[model samples]
Target chain A: MTNLLKNLATTEVLGINRRNQDYLRPLNSPSAKKIADSKLLTKRILRRSNIQTPELFKVIRTEKQLKYVDWSSLPKSFVIKPNQGSRGRGILIVYGKKKGSEQAWIQSNNQIVRIKDFESHIMQIFEGRFSLGSRRDIALIEERLKTDKLLKKYSYKGVPDIRIIVYNSIPLMAMTRLPTKESNGKANLHAGAICVGIDIGSGITINGIHLKSKSLLSDTYEPIEMTYDQKINLPIKGIEIPNWDEILEIAVKCQRESGLGYAGVDIAIDRDKGPMVFELNARPGLGIQVTNNAGLRFRLERVAGIKVKNTKHAVRIAKNLFGGSVSEEIELLSGRQIANLVEKITLFEKGKYKVKRKRKKLKQGTLLVKGLLDTGLLTSRIDRDTAAKLGFIDAIKSFNSYEIPKVFNSFEEAQAYIDKMDNTISKHEDIVRLAKITEEGKIRVRPVISVNLLIKGIHKNIEVIISTRKELIYPILIGRRELKDFLIDASKTFTR
Target chain B: MILPNLPHGIIVLLLFLPVIATIANFARYVLGIRTLGIYPALSLAFAFLLTGFRYGMIITTLVFAISSLSYSLIKYTRMHYVSKITVIYTANAIFLILAFTLFTQAPFFSNVLNLDFNEINPAGVLLIAVLIDFFVKQTVKKDWFTATRSFIETIIVSSIGFLIIRIPRFDLILVKYAWIIPLLIIVNVIIGQGSNLKLLEILRFKQIIVKPNPQDDKSS
Candidate 1:
């Protein structure tokens, strides 16, 4: 407990309560909070000053508008928003017109949206289901921006928005939010979007902090350096966000125009229109601190009373004073790589021989003493002895029935041995698949069983090829499926 | 130590208010328990204090079951928010009063020591009924698990308040010392300006705290 307190104090991470009381309450006026609470109000305030915002299509405040509105007259692609929704609630995205349907559109998940769906959704808005403090709110439709070309490759389904924290017209900290498929394309951190910290000066993305995608570790969040798909080639780090300066300028303009002393401005880039202001938040989340691995309190305190000449001047001052080390940020982002050749890995097995329907499953198995992080291999391999020890005795029992050939066997011989098995052999609950391997100058047939890997509290279900590796040192070998999470480094002790 | 001028109700209510607030703060910051804000918890605690323990539990449980049923029935209706809540609360109130009538007349009650329905304050009953609003809103917006968790936490915190008030002469002690009420204001300020990480948030921001994972780097 003492260690937790000392580390937290040293990090100077601000809590939600403190953010509201000390910074938001004292700094922001009640009228400013009122403006920030309503998206339409903030957009109107900014659009009056000629700042770029998504053009509003329509507003629905009553059932009359919701019922009589022409669905066909609407654009093929647009977004529905509750004017006072918090944390991206009561927001719906229509992808495009469905095939052969006059009044229906497709959603991000390919669900059909018709007049009835639209009516009920807007009815909820009228009922104040998603509004702040359960007050009745107006619903609006705005043009949906396509994910920019540079960021499209990193995001899964929707556009990625950058959240900038501005104080006294100067941008202090920023983080890019990517909409993953798991988040239903909302880009809400609570809804499972990827949040990566961005350097205020360079606009280069650092590490991303997102919820682990496994249900077994449902409430656990971890730092990641890869895209949602865990694609190695599409790394999340070091990607230059397009239109950095314009986004910062627009954020500053929004903060100044909205009359918010300290504000959070969300800006998303359109593939064609460039950076456009999405919305403004009066009291933003403190997750940016964890993403940046820096304390917001320290940064806010450092420039609390400084004077700025103009928007450009404020941006310049921020770049000079509050900017972090760009090189260190890049290195730190890349450090999620598990660098060791042989590392300890935990495997989870079924507690019972046959898991009944809806039963408590996955008794965590004994930690594999040593696992080889073999990058050259495409699929993970586990020695037969280790697999049996990890509760895959059924696969070993079936393998033992096959007679052992003394002579060096060929690939066809191993394939023939697997092909001769009866239908019951493939029905083993532990066995995921079968694979043919050429090892030690001969052919080896192994069963690929499903196993859960728990590394640094990140849970993943990976297939391991059960092989006879009694002579080998390491019992298990992890392959390139998740090899991106690990990196080869010279020394294990790379203290930040 | 009883004050001669003030009614016992007001005096006890005043004493219990600060204790309930302190309990709520302790629950929120130190234990990381979230209830339906603080107002619902405060009133519910007072109601529990007025009705005693077993009766309080019975009434709260009845409210939870009846209010949820009423909400599920009225949610899809074409009524406005205020009217829908009014309908649900009316249904709850009808059943609550009917249950009291049955309990007062039941033959088994006399064997266990009969409960006097007239003794329970009408204000206390109204206070407990206000929790139905939180339940309806939670069901409308959030999932059952979250709504149920908040309700349970609220009940637990209120029960703590009731238990504190139940202690022999707990109110007399407060009446003897009048400074404790204003002193609680300082406690609230400290809680508001608190710098340390909350117990729940420590786990939430675990990514920020650098863990020196003594790496055993021996590889053959």
Candidate 2:
């Protein structure tokens, strides 16, 4: 009991309540919500920005419209839904018109529905039976999405779709709702469907959790162990969603165009059309936290109020900062952590003062340098004369036995060196190997030395090639290969 | 002029707080005003107006003090929520009966304390008792410290409203033009529509508005 309580207190469990109280209620204005909750409005807004939505066959706004509707002209497979419906209620999926009966249709659950049934359903919709608070509503018949081959296995019969919770234009979390026999062919979790959490960065499903049987008492209530059926196990995780980039792009676009600060964007991949957004919900349920096995509050809080320029920028920030397992994989493969483009590095000089340069020695030095970290360079570099003064001459000489190159303080001097070198070193293999082009177009055979650096209290051993400081403003330059543990922030300069 | 001895001015002003509070509660319901420690201020004001400030203050203070004390003690006793609330209210009822008896007889200076058992309306006491019970029960649902803080805040808000209604000039204006009371509805509507950001949200999102120098947009 105590353990369950403790887990409930964790951010993942409490995030739902916190997000509702803070983010959803505050960020999503009531007017913005009208746009999301109404399917017609959502489609109109999303369509304006070129975001694809399932084609609308017809909208039955009145009982008279329902009576006059040409039943035979409707698509072989279409979805009938109430404009203000929620939790998959008031949704009737017609697989196809029953064999020879022109008015009869077969639902995903295998229930036969005649034209009269659809009329009654549309009448109920007009009467607001399934609308929010049972207010009057319209009914829409949309083209039913053909489930992608990869997703068909997880669902029982109904087509599963991706639900992404977007906050502040950032897609925070995603999950796929799979239909189950227990749910009567509906992909609604409360009806016993399985919800599979998907990693936002990788687009791969992570874990599965089902809604527990509601028949049990409160004290006995617990989410049941997920199983494929009464016997076999379903492989719910590791399902790779195709066109995940498009899915994320459309979800963010929906949020941006809807003018909702927080939104839940539902998208489905059609067999041929790729991804199409189906709905946008302003007050999206927090069941996604349980489905994702991660908290939404922290991710939403992390991205809140940060200015995002476009969908790409928002998606990149979300993936890089809160990408979950994908980031861990990158760190594992690179054998290093990712950092910013600029970093602070402390440069070490003499004990008190020494024009010291030795081949090898154990020395403690001081001289903090704000190094401009660049990944383009193959090796780290520093000013030649400054390196020699810092006692790196011996180490450099021992590494390659190269004599000190003449220091050029001006661009003209470096340009002069490049002209002279073009005649000699440009033609010879060994000479060319010894010389490398600088940012200023000059060439030099600078020696390399391994030095210790202390950045933000982390000690690092980096090998820097010696170069002339004449053209560069920064004396020390740290390259990508040398930056392993440190995260560079280009916005930040040297802090000592 | 029709009822000169009735002190119609004070009576009309006494009605102002409840009317304003009713409008405020309606605003709370429709617009979702979630600022803390403000909901029951009107009931407290009504309680104070029905009985003089001293008696009203005594009942509110005693109910809150006793109920909150019992609430904190009963929390560790392993009872269900309904049963625990029952225990706190029962303790409060017993304390109220005992305190009322003691206040009527204890002659510190009779002039200062206006409470008399014979004149005290049982219905008024019951209403105050119920409000106290609800105030404690609702606030304690969150946490002990919150319950205690809200109890004090509720009383403080009621006392301020009570003092405002007592002002002579304000009382005269309300009685002279009872039609002016409808203006409060318009005032509340404007107040609700004007500010979308709550008091706390303004402070919370202050950093977004007071931006630093525009040089570093990339770094967090």
Candidate 3:
């Protein structure tokens, strides 16, 4: 059955994934590229655009500056980072107040980093050890924003931020990345953070939950029919994001400024500040697909040819076109109503179809047949009681002749009697070794039978085992291996 | 019996060696400690552990002096960055050749040059080449003070790298679980996002701000 499912099943449901790099590769925009590749330029552009980012206190262009700066002037809760640093390399986050005149403490993984340790760390950063391409870089210390209350429970200790993918000035998708204890208080999935996709129309997260175990309600679940439970459904359903319109405008303006057609805007909602633009990403992760559980290929294709006039119109189109439609589509694709229902089977013999009718009509009595074709089964099998009633009693006598023990009781004895004769007459080989035998219900019989089968349509002959307890829904169990050629239209009613 | 596979062990070693070199380079460049390039700084530390610190420092200084002279002479003619690095690397190789000559002819330096050259350990030579390359590049790019500062940063970074590599506990953990790479990448991202200050800018900001220049006064 496993083999058959592997061969027959279509992978259409699994097609939607977050890491679909190929689909997003062509939509790479210029603005996103500039922001990701050049940090200095990004800071300059953001500052010029009136976007609130971490203040760049100073820049060190030459060695002269290295000799002159007073290290004591640095603030307590400041962060130091490299300009060309990609991923999260070469960054130092300092926290806590000064205890003594010379020594200041830093908070890292709930531990205190002394001032000496901090200075050494800064020196490492200055050396370009964390810089991209191993080029020399300037490190700047800026104020760290205090995180808001709504995200406090979701995040460990780091600042939780929102990632919005903007394409052609349209905010296509958004997700809030939260820090976890596992992530060591860093709100990066690669750093152990979990990503929760946000519904664009409603500020409520589409798929996000506190990392606690519970039986999820039916309506809140995504990809409705998918049996696997992975993503968390956010509690808030339709709260409008604070600066939705402004965010859209910023995205459009950034697109125009950076000259990139597709980009991702990272925005942090500070407790004091409303929505501060953090940084721009040129190559955004495809993991957002898994967060949303929808393919980007379809969305990208839909927007590719459209002429986007303004940010408002683009947002309208994105909301009207995609919105929650992808989620619905995913639900439909994974629902259980479409799955196939097939049973396992074992075949024992090969034979031509022969029809026999009673020649004369007599008093009504149950007329049993020795050879009964279980067409529902992939392999031929016989019922013991029916075989005995049909006068195949000698079949049971021949069981001992094949060196097989007569281990059956009164009821199984009759059934085995019929099975043995059918095996002898049909030239069927019993290859299945009996592992265990037990009575299921009122039926007293050998439940398992081993048989060699030659399927009618296909040329391959196979050995299999069968259980006859299931006589109501299916008289025969056809394992998946036997159903190689014929396609089963599960949606259609069985013909025979 | 629980040791890592040969290929994986080799890969770990390869990764660890470069990281040690990089860290040493970083320390020397930033912290202002003097060490023979990233490789030599780390290698010397290792050599110090095997031989005594006095013996290790003596061998390191002798090799560095010879390699520096060869590198400076090679730099008399201008070359591209790649070519310059290549020249410095070749000079280090020549230094190794000279070491053998000194070992055979002069018994005084023989004790310091007791390492087997026939073994031709590329990792060791690569380390020396890295140190020489770093030293030569710094000397050429900036004045002596900047070069010296960078040298310090290199030493700090290399020492950290060397210590990380040498620690049996860390080595065992890293070897057993390679998932640390992703974790490192995440940490890198967080650092990238959190940091706003450039270390060099902090180091230089005071001088640039404190002294009002004559040219600026004239312009004003």
Candidate 4:
């Protein structure tokens, strides 16, 4: 098992990671330049660049702002997010105003959260408990992006954002992060959002595209009703980004200013404003390799040591090397074969049997004995009734039965019979000698003899005091002493 | 056949004394305490363990008083970084000469401090060398406060280095788990990556503040 674990660690579950790193390392420059992370820096950069973002109604930075800011000023549709939060931990999106008062209603799962509850939730953000690294943070309220009609049927009350991996000033790959009910309306994959890679030149989605009929409002709880018929496709294919050239230019300028060789630029399109530079990332996630289903090591290695005089040259080089489109690569790599459902489980039992048959055969006439394998625990236990049932009735009678104490004393002398079936029983000693037999309208029986039992698997043996326990569900408890040989894999199932 | 190996033991003890003296001086002078002129204090302590306390203390006091008076006159002039270090060594040599002269003159001390000029000990010279190196580092740097801070850090680091060198048990364990060095490097890298928090303007939220007038701030 240890050898298996060592082998598993070395096995390549995914090949794209090694390729991506190889491609990125050469373009990466080591410099100490601070570019604000997405949540803080993107908002500032967008406003400076004259790009329209969600309207910020109010910011609660201090206790004064928290006290004076009017709740009534907030629109029915708004989003409250922590300014310094990451992985979408503290974001609340309000879908509509409640029936009574000026209170807002938030969609959490299938339920509606009241305005007071939402404010209390914001208090968690104010304390910075959910902030990145648990540092202090301020919360901001902004205008929520209305879910587009096309994507409305596919999502709950969540907004989707596009992530563009820009390396050395060129946009290499792009993906649309979609929020599912599973994602709790957050567009962060770490927060359960599904990442669907999109073509850079074209806006078509590559994987996990859901084409559903009903509007998002109707069935809030169920999975989006995907037909699997009229294949779900991204609507904006071949339609160039509103400001593609400008976005690329901003990425190049930002890279030069920040001195970061590799980066990711997140851009969102505002209904009124075209394309806004959302944020720039220094150490971008390697999951983009999985999204593109291409190895980054190969791409990174190809660009290594290649000097680019300008952004135009960099873009040309990137396009010439990694371009040609991913759809063809995906088809060629996967080979037109549908994925197999059965391949999900690699380990299978040889023969199939009904669940009922397996349970009955184990419980039928076998004597149940509970022992503590605890290298630490010093005892093993057995019930008298179980021993009698396992053809020990004659032995019990010769030892003097009816009463608990007499039966216990008689079984000590009969240790020779118990030793024949199992060799490890050393000796029988003092009986527990119970004063009274109390049963709630049930038959009471006691086992005689405290026996020393040796476990088959572990290094140590335990001397357990045996007694009948009728209420135990499993009828036997294997203590820690017996469990030394195996390391628990929390991901596996355990059955007796 | 085993002849007690007197020469080898003497050689090892000779090598060990300088390291012990420098460590003691580092703890006392740099960390701001007091100790006798480097060698006599270390030698007296070792001798007190070998001989009786009354005899060792008498010789130690006579030697320390003479060296302190000689070292006082040596600190008169300002010099360059390397020259300053030379001054410290010159001061120690003069102190050693004064101690030898005073010990020979004292009737009680001369009988107890029985050692020839040939046995004058290179370990004391090595200890003075360490002190000179430290003195040079402290005087040469432009930032006095930073230099002093580094001096304190050096003392602390060398103390740890000394303890690791002296203790065999700790040395063996560190040798066994040499892989810890690479693991520590990886941990430092992860810490470096995690601490980076990007600027607000780069994060793209635009509505937080109004534009600041740069001219007004400059004039004020």
| Fnat for each model | 0.30, 0.00, 0.00, 0.00
Docking class of 1: incorrect
lDDT per residue (tens digit) for residues A190-214 in model 2: 6777888777866888667775443
1 or 3, greater by lDDT:
1
> What is candidate 3's lDDT per residue for B21-116, written digit by digit as tens?
545533333332445354556664455434443443444455557656765675545334456567666766676667666665776654564644
Candidate 2, CAPRI quality class derived from DockQ = incorrect
Considering chain A alone, what is the TM-score of candidate 1? 0.64
Number of the top-ranking candidate, with lDDT as the measure = 1
Q: lDDT of each prediction vs. the true structure?
A: 0.76, 0.66, 0.51, 0.45
* A326-375: candidate 3 lDDT, tens digit per residue: 33333456541111233222232323122222433322232312222223
Question: Looking at candidate 1, what is the lDDT of residue B11?
Answer: 79
Over A1-496, each residue of candidate 4 has an lDDT whose tens digit, in order, gives 3443443333222122232343334444444113434355556555665555567887778766676767777777777888866556667777767678575574555457765565565666666645654566788888777655544444445766667666546666666666766667766654445566555433455543322222211101112213221235233222234454555555565555555677676665555555555455655664554454443434544455678888767655554455434434444565532111111111111121112333533333333243322233233343445434444444445334333232323344334334342222222123323222223333333333323222221223322233455663332333443344333222212112
Question: Model 4 lDDT vs. the true structure?
Answer: 0.45
Best by DockQ: 1
Clashes of each: 1, 4, 57, 46
lDDT, ranked from best to worst: 1, 2, 3, 4
Cα error of candidate 3 at position A361, Å? 63
Q: Per-prediction RMSD in angstroms?
A: 19.1, 15.1, 24.8, 29.8
